[model samples]
Target: MRRGRDEQGQVSLLIIGFAGVIAMVIAVVVDASAAYLQRSGLDTLADGAALHGADLGATGEDVYTGGLPEERLALTEPAVRAAVGDYLRRVGAHRSYPGLTFTVAVDGAESVTVRISAPLDLPLRFPGSPADTTVSATGSAVSTVD
Candidate 1:
Protein backbone atom coordinates (compact mmCIF):
# COMPACT_ATOMS: atom_id res chain seq x y z
CA MET A 1 0.00 0.00 0.00
CA ARG A 2 2.87 2.42 0.79
CA ARG A 3 4.64 1.58 -2.45
CA GLY A 4 1.42 2.13 -4.47
CA ARG A 5 0.95 5.58 -2.97
CA ASP A 6 4.57 6.56 -3.71
CA GLU A 7 4.29 5.38 -7.34
CA GLN A 8 1.06 7.37 -7.82
CA GLY A 9 2.91 10.65 -7.02
CA GLN A 10 5.89 9.64 -9.23
CA VAL A 11 3.72 9.71 -12.36
CA SER A 12 2.45 13.14 -11.46
CA LEU A 13 6.01 14.42 -11.03
CA LEU A 14 6.97 12.97 -14.39
CA ILE A 15 4.00 14.64 -16.05
CA ILE A 16 4.97 18.00 -14.61
CA GLY A 17 8.55 17.62 -15.80
CA PHE A 18 7.39 16.64 -19.27
CA ALA A 19 5.06 19.61 -19.41
CA GLY A 20 7.88 21.99 -18.53
CA VAL A 21 10.11 20.53 -21.21
CA ILE A 22 7.35 20.83 -23.77
CA ALA A 23 6.79 24.47 -22.88
CA MET A 24 10.47 25.27 -23.24
CA VAL A 25 10.56 23.53 -26.59
CA ILE A 26 7.59 25.54 -27.76
CA ALA A 27 9.24 28.75 -26.70
CA VAL A 28 12.40 27.88 -28.58
CA VAL A 29 10.49 27.03 -31.75
CA VAL A 30 8.48 30.23 -31.62
CA ASP A 31 11.57 32.36 -31.13
CA ALA A 32 13.39 30.59 -33.93
CA SER A 33 10.45 31.08 -36.29
CA ALA A 34 10.31 34.75 -35.49
CA ALA A 35 14.01 35.14 -36.18
CA TYR A 36 13.66 33.34 -39.48
CA LEU A 37 10.84 35.60 -40.59
CA GLN A 38 12.79 38.68 -39.62
CA ARG A 39 15.80 37.49 -41.58
CA SER A 40 13.63 36.91 -44.66
CA GLY A 41 12.20 40.39 -44.46
CA LEU A 42 15.65 41.90 -44.09
CA ASP A 43 16.86 39.99 -47.10
CA THR A 44 14.02 41.33 -49.21
CA LEU A 45 14.75 44.86 -48.12
CA ALA A 46 18.43 44.47 -48.96
CA ASP A 47 17.59 43.14 -52.39
CA GLY A 48 15.31 46.05 -53.14
CA ALA A 49 17.86 48.59 -51.94
CA ALA A 50 20.63 46.99 -53.92
CA LEU A 51 18.55 46.96 -57.07
CA HIS A 52 17.65 50.60 -56.62
CA GLY A 53 21.29 51.51 -56.10
CA ALA A 54 22.29 49.62 -59.19
CA ASP A 55 19.65 51.33 -61.26
CA LEU A 56 20.88 54.70 -60.02
CA GLY A 57 24.39 53.76 -60.96
CA ALA A 58 23.23 52.85 -64.43
CA THR A 59 21.38 56.12 -64.79
CA GLY A 60 24.35 58.10 -63.58
CA GLU A 61 26.53 56.67 -66.34
CA ASP A 62 27.30 58.89 -69.32
CA VAL A 63 26.62 57.15 -72.61
CA TYR A 64 29.32 58.40 -74.92
CA THR A 65 28.10 58.94 -78.51
CA GLY A 66 24.70 57.50 -77.53
CA GLY A 67 25.75 53.92 -76.69
CA LEU A 68 28.84 54.27 -78.85
CA PRO A 69 32.55 54.87 -78.05
CA GLU A 70 32.64 51.90 -75.66
CA GLU A 71 29.55 53.11 -73.77
CA ARG A 72 31.31 54.60 -70.76
CA LEU A 73 29.29 53.21 -67.88
CA ALA A 74 30.62 52.87 -64.39
CA LEU A 75 29.31 52.46 -60.84
CA THR A 76 31.19 54.61 -58.38
CA GLU A 77 31.37 53.78 -54.67
CA PRO A 78 30.00 57.09 -53.44
CA ALA A 79 27.13 57.04 -55.89
CA VAL A 80 26.14 53.53 -54.88
CA ARG A 81 26.20 54.40 -51.19
CA ALA A 82 24.17 57.53 -51.74
CA ALA A 83 21.60 55.69 -53.82
CA VAL A 84 21.19 53.00 -51.18
CA GLY A 85 20.80 55.54 -48.43
CA ASP A 86 18.22 57.46 -50.37
CA TYR A 87 16.29 54.32 -51.19
CA LEU A 88 16.18 53.23 -47.57
CA ARG A 89 15.03 56.61 -46.45
CA ARG A 90 12.43 56.92 -49.17
CA VAL A 91 11.02 53.49 -48.37
CA GLY A 92 10.84 54.24 -44.63
CA ALA A 93 12.86 51.14 -43.82
CA HIS A 94 14.54 52.75 -40.83
CA ARG A 95 11.22 53.75 -39.38
CA SER A 96 9.76 50.30 -39.93
CA TYR A 97 12.64 48.52 -38.23
CA PRO A 98 13.92 50.65 -35.42
CA GLY A 99 16.94 48.46 -34.77
CA LEU A 100 17.90 48.08 -38.41
CA THR A 101 21.39 49.00 -39.63
CA PHE A 102 22.83 48.69 -43.09
CA THR A 103 25.90 49.21 -45.24
CA VAL A 104 26.23 49.84 -48.95
CA ALA A 105 29.25 49.22 -51.15
CA VAL A 106 30.06 49.12 -54.83
CA ASP A 107 31.16 45.64 -55.78
CA GLY A 108 33.58 46.16 -58.62
CA ALA A 109 32.77 48.64 -61.37
CA GLU A 110 29.42 47.21 -62.42
CA SER A 111 27.67 45.95 -59.33
CA VAL A 112 26.28 47.41 -56.11
CA THR A 113 25.75 45.46 -52.89
CA VAL A 114 23.86 46.17 -49.71
CA ARG A 115 24.09 44.46 -46.38
CA ILE A 116 21.30 44.86 -43.84
CA SER A 117 21.14 43.80 -40.24
CA ALA A 118 18.56 44.00 -37.49
CA PRO A 119 18.05 42.70 -33.99
CA LEU A 120 15.04 40.54 -33.15
CA ASP A 121 13.47 40.53 -29.71
CA LEU A 122 12.30 37.24 -28.36
CA PRO A 123 9.09 37.03 -26.42
CA LEU A 124 10.41 34.35 -24.10
CA ARG A 125 13.99 34.12 -22.90
CA PHE A 126 15.47 30.76 -22.14
CA PRO A 127 18.45 30.02 -19.94
CA GLY A 128 21.75 30.27 -21.81
CA SER A 129 19.94 31.88 -24.76
CA PRO A 130 20.14 35.47 -25.84
CA ALA A 131 17.14 37.72 -25.37
CA ASP A 132 17.87 39.51 -28.63
CA THR A 133 19.31 37.95 -31.76
CA THR A 134 20.93 39.78 -34.64
CA VAL A 135 19.98 38.81 -38.18
CA SER A 136 21.89 39.90 -41.26
CA ALA A 137 21.27 39.73 -45.02
CA THR A 138 23.17 40.75 -48.16
CA GLY A 139 22.02 41.58 -51.71
CA SER A 140 23.77 42.53 -54.91
CA ALA A 141 22.73 44.03 -58.23
CA VAL A 142 24.57 44.51 -61.50
CA SER A 143 24.42 47.60 -63.64
CA THR A 144 23.98 47.16 -67.36
CA VAL A 145 24.53 49.80 -69.98
CA ASP A 146 22.08 48.24 -72.41
Candidate 2:
Protein backbone atom coordinates (compact mmCIF):
# COMPACT_ATOMS: atom_id res chain seq x y z
CA MET A 1 0.00 0.00 0.00
CA ARG A 2 2.86 2.40 0.88
CA ARG A 3 4.73 1.43 -2.34
CA GLY A 4 1.66 2.25 -4.40
CA ARG A 5 1.36 5.65 -2.70
CA ASP A 6 5.04 6.41 -3.32
CA GLU A 7 4.73 5.55 -7.02
CA GLN A 8 1.62 7.76 -7.35
CA GLY A 9 3.62 10.99 -6.73
CA GLN A 10 6.64 9.81 -8.73
CA VAL A 11 4.76 10.25 -11.98
CA SER A 12 4.18 13.90 -11.16
CA LEU A 13 7.90 14.44 -10.84
CA LEU A 14 8.52 12.71 -14.16
CA ILE A 15 5.85 14.84 -15.79
CA ILE A 16 7.43 18.00 -14.45
CA GLY A 17 10.85 16.99 -15.79
CA PHE A 18 9.43 16.25 -19.22
CA ALA A 19 7.70 19.60 -19.27
CA GLY A 20 10.97 21.35 -18.48
CA VAL A 21 12.73 19.60 -21.33
CA ILE A 22 9.99 20.54 -23.75
CA ALA A 23 10.12 24.14 -22.64
CA MET A 24 13.84 24.28 -23.18
CA VAL A 25 13.48 22.82 -26.65
CA ILE A 26 10.85 25.38 -27.51
CA ALA A 27 13.05 28.20 -26.30
CA VAL A 28 15.95 26.99 -28.40
CA VAL A 29 13.79 26.74 -31.50
CA VAL A 30 12.37 30.23 -31.05
CA ASP A 31 15.73 31.84 -30.43
CA ALA A 32 17.33 30.04 -33.35
CA SER A 33 14.57 31.11 -35.70
CA ALA A 34 14.92 34.72 -34.57
CA ALA A 35 18.64 34.65 -35.19
CA TYR A 36 18.17 33.19 -38.68
CA LEU A 37 15.66 35.86 -39.59
CA GLN A 38 17.94 38.61 -38.32
CA ARG A 39 20.76 37.26 -40.46
CA SER A 40 18.52 37.21 -43.52
CA GLY A 41 17.53 40.83 -42.92
CA LEU A 42 21.15 41.89 -42.64
CA ASP A 43 21.95 40.07 -45.89
CA THR A 44 19.14 41.84 -47.72
CA LEU A 45 20.31 45.23 -46.50
CA ALA A 46 23.88 44.58 -47.58
CA ASP A 47 22.77 43.38 -51.01
CA GLY A 48 20.67 46.46 -51.59
CA ALA A 49 23.48 48.79 -50.55
CA ALA A 50 25.98 47.01 -52.79
CA LEU A 51 23.65 47.10 -55.77
CA HIS A 52 23.01 50.80 -55.25
CA GLY A 53 26.72 51.49 -55.12
CA ALA A 54 27.33 49.55 -58.32
CA ASP A 55 24.63 51.50 -60.16
CA LEU A 56 26.27 54.86 -59.57
CA GLY A 57 28.01 56.07 -62.71
CA ALA A 58 31.35 57.80 -62.65
CA THR A 59 31.17 61.59 -62.50
CA GLY A 60 31.82 63.92 -65.48
CA GLU A 61 31.23 61.27 -68.13
CA ASP A 62 29.92 61.72 -71.67
CA VAL A 63 26.67 59.79 -72.17
CA TYR A 64 26.72 60.57 -75.91
CA THR A 65 29.34 57.91 -76.54
CA GLY A 66 28.04 55.34 -79.04
CA GLY A 67 29.35 52.55 -76.85
CA LEU A 68 29.57 52.42 -73.06
CA PRO A 69 32.86 53.99 -72.06
CA GLU A 70 35.06 52.30 -69.49
CA GLU A 71 35.60 55.59 -67.66
CA ARG A 72 31.86 56.14 -67.29
CA LEU A 73 31.19 52.62 -66.05
CA ALA A 74 34.19 52.35 -63.72
CA LEU A 75 33.51 51.83 -60.03
CA THR A 76 35.74 54.03 -57.88
CA GLU A 77 36.37 53.28 -54.24
CA PRO A 78 35.30 56.73 -53.03
CA ALA A 79 32.16 56.69 -55.16
CA VAL A 80 31.21 53.20 -54.03
CA ARG A 81 31.73 54.05 -50.38
CA ALA A 82 29.72 57.25 -50.68
CA ALA A 83 26.84 55.50 -52.43
CA VAL A 84 26.74 52.73 -49.85
CA GLY A 85 26.81 55.21 -46.96
CA ASP A 86 24.01 57.24 -48.51
CA TYR A 87 21.85 54.19 -49.05
CA LEU A 88 22.35 52.91 -45.52
CA ARG A 89 21.52 56.32 -44.08
CA ARG A 90 18.48 56.73 -46.29
CA VAL A 91 17.13 53.36 -45.21
CA GLY A 92 17.92 54.03 -41.53
CA ALA A 93 19.60 50.65 -41.23
CA HIS A 94 21.73 51.76 -38.30
CA ARG A 95 18.66 52.96 -36.45
CA SER A 96 16.88 49.67 -37.13
CA TYR A 97 19.81 47.60 -35.84
CA PRO A 98 21.39 49.30 -32.90
CA GLY A 99 25.15 48.79 -32.54
CA LEU A 100 25.44 47.70 -36.14
CA THR A 101 28.72 48.00 -38.01
CA PHE A 102 29.40 47.87 -41.72
CA THR A 103 32.15 48.08 -44.29
CA VAL A 104 32.05 49.05 -47.96
CA ALA A 105 34.75 48.66 -50.54
CA VAL A 106 35.30 48.28 -54.24
CA ASP A 107 35.70 44.58 -54.87
CA GLY A 108 37.19 45.09 -58.34
CA ALA A 109 37.33 47.65 -61.07
CA GLU A 110 33.63 47.26 -61.64
CA SER A 111 32.27 45.56 -58.51
CA VAL A 112 31.17 46.88 -55.12
CA THR A 113 31.13 44.83 -51.92
CA VAL A 114 29.34 45.53 -48.68
CA ARG A 115 29.49 43.72 -45.34
CA ILE A 116 27.11 44.32 -42.46
CA SER A 117 27.18 42.90 -38.95
CA ALA A 118 25.02 43.07 -35.83
CA PRO A 119 24.57 41.29 -32.52
CA LEU A 120 21.41 39.38 -31.61
CA ASP A 121 20.30 38.73 -28.06
CA LEU A 122 18.81 35.33 -27.32
CA PRO A 123 15.31 35.16 -25.98
CA LEU A 124 16.19 32.52 -23.41
CA ARG A 125 19.15 31.86 -21.18
CA PHE A 126 20.85 28.48 -20.82
CA PRO A 127 23.89 27.04 -19.11
CA GLY A 128 27.05 27.57 -21.16
CA SER A 129 25.07 29.35 -23.84
CA PRO A 130 26.03 32.78 -25.06
CA ALA A 131 23.68 35.61 -24.16
CA ASP A 132 24.11 37.16 -27.57
CA THR A 133 25.34 36.03 -30.97
CA THR A 134 26.99 37.99 -33.78
CA VAL A 135 25.40 37.88 -37.20
CA SER A 136 27.14 39.13 -40.34
CA ALA A 137 26.47 39.10 -44.07
CA THR A 138 28.37 40.17 -47.20
CA GLY A 139 27.01 41.22 -50.58
CA SER A 140 28.63 42.12 -53.90
CA ALA A 141 27.40 43.71 -57.11
CA VAL A 142 29.12 44.08 -60.47
CA SER A 143 28.59 47.01 -62.81
CA THR A 144 27.24 45.79 -66.15
CA VAL A 145 27.51 48.99 -68.16
CA ASP A 146 31.00 48.07 -69.30
Candidate 3:
Protein backbone atom coordinates (compact mmCIF):
# COMPACT_ATOMS: atom_id res chain seq x y z
CA MET A 1 0.00 0.00 0.00
CA ARG A 2 2.80 2.46 0.81
CA ARG A 3 4.64 1.76 -2.46
CA GLY A 4 1.48 2.16 -4.53
CA ARG A 5 0.73 5.54 -2.96
CA ASP A 6 4.29 6.80 -3.55
CA GLU A 7 4.08 5.91 -7.29
CA GLN A 8 0.55 7.22 -7.78
CA GLY A 9 1.57 10.32 -9.80
CA GLN A 10 4.62 8.86 -11.57
CA VAL A 11 2.69 7.91 -14.74
CA SER A 12 1.31 11.43 -15.05
CA LEU A 13 4.86 12.84 -14.89
CA LEU A 14 5.96 10.47 -17.63
CA ILE A 15 3.00 11.43 -19.81
CA ILE A 16 3.79 15.09 -19.42
CA GLY A 17 7.38 14.58 -20.48
CA PHE A 18 6.31 12.61 -23.53
CA ALA A 19 3.84 15.34 -24.49
CA GLY A 20 6.61 17.93 -24.37
CA VAL A 21 8.86 15.86 -26.57
CA ILE A 22 6.04 15.37 -29.06
CA ALA A 23 5.41 19.11 -29.27
CA MET A 24 9.08 19.82 -29.94
CA VAL A 25 9.17 17.24 -32.72
CA ILE A 26 6.09 18.73 -34.33
CA ALA A 27 7.62 22.17 -34.22
CA VAL A 28 10.80 20.95 -35.88
CA VAL A 29 8.90 19.18 -38.64
CA VAL A 30 6.75 22.19 -39.42
CA ASP A 31 9.73 24.54 -39.59
CA ALA A 32 11.72 22.20 -41.79
CA SER A 33 8.81 21.75 -44.19
CA ALA A 34 8.32 25.47 -44.48
CA ALA A 35 12.01 25.97 -45.28
CA TYR A 36 11.93 23.28 -47.93
CA LEU A 37 8.91 24.80 -49.63
CA GLN A 38 10.53 28.22 -49.64
CA ARG A 39 13.65 26.79 -51.20
CA SER A 40 11.62 25.11 -53.93
CA GLY A 41 9.90 28.34 -54.85
CA LEU A 42 13.21 30.15 -54.96
CA ASP A 43 14.62 27.46 -57.18
CA THR A 44 11.88 28.03 -59.73
CA LEU A 45 12.39 31.76 -59.69
CA ALA A 46 16.13 31.41 -60.15
CA ASP A 47 15.72 29.02 -63.06
CA GLY A 48 13.41 31.36 -64.91
CA ALA A 49 15.70 34.31 -64.32
CA ALA A 50 18.71 32.39 -65.56
CA LEU A 51 16.97 31.21 -68.67
CA HIS A 52 15.75 34.67 -69.52
CA GLY A 53 19.21 36.09 -69.02
CA ALA A 54 20.77 33.48 -71.24
CA ASP A 55 18.26 33.98 -74.01
CA LEU A 56 18.65 37.72 -74.17
CA GLY A 57 22.27 38.18 -73.15
CA ALA A 58 23.90 35.37 -75.05
CA THR A 59 22.96 36.98 -78.34
CA GLY A 60 24.72 40.00 -79.77
CA GLU A 61 23.89 42.28 -82.68
CA ASP A 62 26.71 40.53 -84.45
CA VAL A 63 24.70 37.34 -84.40
CA TYR A 64 22.14 38.98 -86.67
CA THR A 65 24.83 40.31 -89.02
CA GLY A 66 27.11 37.29 -88.77
CA GLY A 67 24.49 34.59 -88.20
CA LEU A 68 24.30 32.05 -85.37
CA PRO A 69 27.59 30.81 -83.99
CA GLU A 70 29.05 27.45 -85.01
CA GLU A 71 29.77 26.77 -81.34
CA ARG A 72 28.30 27.93 -78.01
CA LEU A 73 26.79 31.39 -77.71
CA ALA A 74 28.90 34.04 -76.04
CA LEU A 75 27.48 35.36 -72.78
CA THR A 76 28.24 38.86 -71.54
CA GLU A 77 28.14 39.91 -67.91
CA PRO A 78 26.55 43.33 -68.39
CA ALA A 79 23.86 42.04 -70.72
CA VAL A 80 23.08 39.12 -68.42
CA ARG A 81 22.77 41.39 -65.39
CA ALA A 82 20.38 43.70 -67.20
CA ALA A 83 18.29 40.85 -68.54
CA VAL A 84 18.04 39.22 -65.10
CA GLY A 85 16.93 42.49 -63.52
CA ASP A 86 14.33 42.96 -66.21
CA TYR A 87 12.95 39.46 -65.76
CA LEU A 88 12.66 39.86 -61.99
CA ARG A 89 10.70 43.09 -62.31
CA ARG A 90 8.51 41.76 -65.09
CA VAL A 91 7.59 38.72 -63.02
CA GLY A 92 6.98 40.80 -59.89
CA ALA A 93 9.51 38.75 -57.93
CA HIS A 94 10.15 41.51 -55.42
CA ARG A 95 6.45 41.72 -54.65
CA SER A 96 6.19 37.99 -54.27
CA TYR A 97 9.05 37.53 -51.80
CA PRO A 98 10.04 40.16 -49.32
CA GLY A 99 13.74 40.70 -48.64
CA LEU A 100 14.64 38.78 -51.74
CA THR A 101 18.10 39.20 -53.23
CA PHE A 102 19.74 37.78 -56.33
CA THR A 103 22.91 37.76 -58.38
CA VAL A 104 23.58 37.02 -62.07
CA ALA A 105 26.89 35.91 -63.55
CA VAL A 106 28.09 34.98 -67.00
CA ASP A 107 29.94 31.69 -66.77
CA GLY A 108 32.73 30.78 -69.22
CA ALA A 109 31.16 32.88 -71.98
CA GLU A 110 28.67 30.08 -72.65
CA SER A 111 26.35 29.98 -69.65
CA VAL A 112 24.68 32.21 -67.11
CA THR A 113 24.00 31.50 -63.45
CA VAL A 114 21.46 33.03 -61.13
CA ARG A 115 21.55 32.76 -57.36
CA ILE A 116 18.63 33.96 -55.29
CA SER A 117 18.03 34.27 -51.57
CA ALA A 118 14.94 35.07 -49.59
CA PRO A 119 14.07 35.38 -45.94
CA LEU A 120 11.78 32.71 -44.55
CA ASP A 121 9.68 32.88 -41.40
CA LEU A 122 9.23 29.43 -39.98
CA PRO A 123 5.79 28.43 -38.80
CA LEU A 124 7.19 26.94 -35.61
CA ARG A 125 10.44 27.04 -33.66
CA PHE A 126 11.96 24.66 -31.16
CA PRO A 127 14.24 25.55 -28.30
CA GLY A 128 17.45 25.26 -30.35
CA SER A 129 15.95 26.36 -33.66
CA PRO A 130 15.49 29.76 -35.23
CA ALA A 131 12.17 31.33 -36.17
CA ASP A 132 13.65 33.18 -39.11
CA THR A 133 16.17 31.97 -41.67
CA THR A 134 17.38 32.64 -45.17
CA VAL A 135 16.77 30.12 -47.95
CA SER A 136 18.71 30.22 -51.21
CA ALA A 137 18.66 28.56 -54.63
CA THR A 138 20.90 28.54 -57.67
CA GLY A 139 20.01 28.10 -61.34
CA SER A 140 22.09 28.06 -64.49
CA ALA A 141 21.52 27.93 -68.22
CA VAL A 142 23.87 27.21 -71.10
CA SER A 143 23.48 28.46 -74.65
CA THR A 144 24.26 26.06 -77.48
CA VAL A 145 23.98 26.93 -81.15
CA ASP A 146 22.17 23.70 -81.78
RMSD of each: 2.7, 3.5, 2.0
TM-score of 1: 0.86
TM-score of candidate 3 to 2 decimals: 0.88
**After superposition, candidate 3 runs with Cα above 4 Å error:** 1-5, 60-67
* Model 1 residue 105 lDDT score: 81
lDDT, model 1:
0.81
What local distance difference test score does each model get? Answer: 0.81, 0.80, 0.88
What tens-digit string does per-residue lDDT give for candidate 1 at 1-146? 34534456788899999999999999999988988888898898999999998888555545333452244357777777888889889988888778889888886677888999988888788788985689899999887655
Give residue 13's error in model 1 in angstroms. Answer: 1.2
Better of 1 and 2 by lDDT: 1
The TM-score values for the models, in the order shown, are 0.86, 0.82, 0.88
- Candidate 2, 1-146: lDDT as tens digits: 34534456788999999999998888899888988999999999999999988886343143344446645366677777888888988999988888888888775567788999998888787776786688899999887753
Error of 3 at 123 (Å): 0.9
* Best model per TM-score: 3
Off by over 4 Å in 1: 1-5, 61-72
Cα distance off (Å), candidate 2, residue 117:
0.5
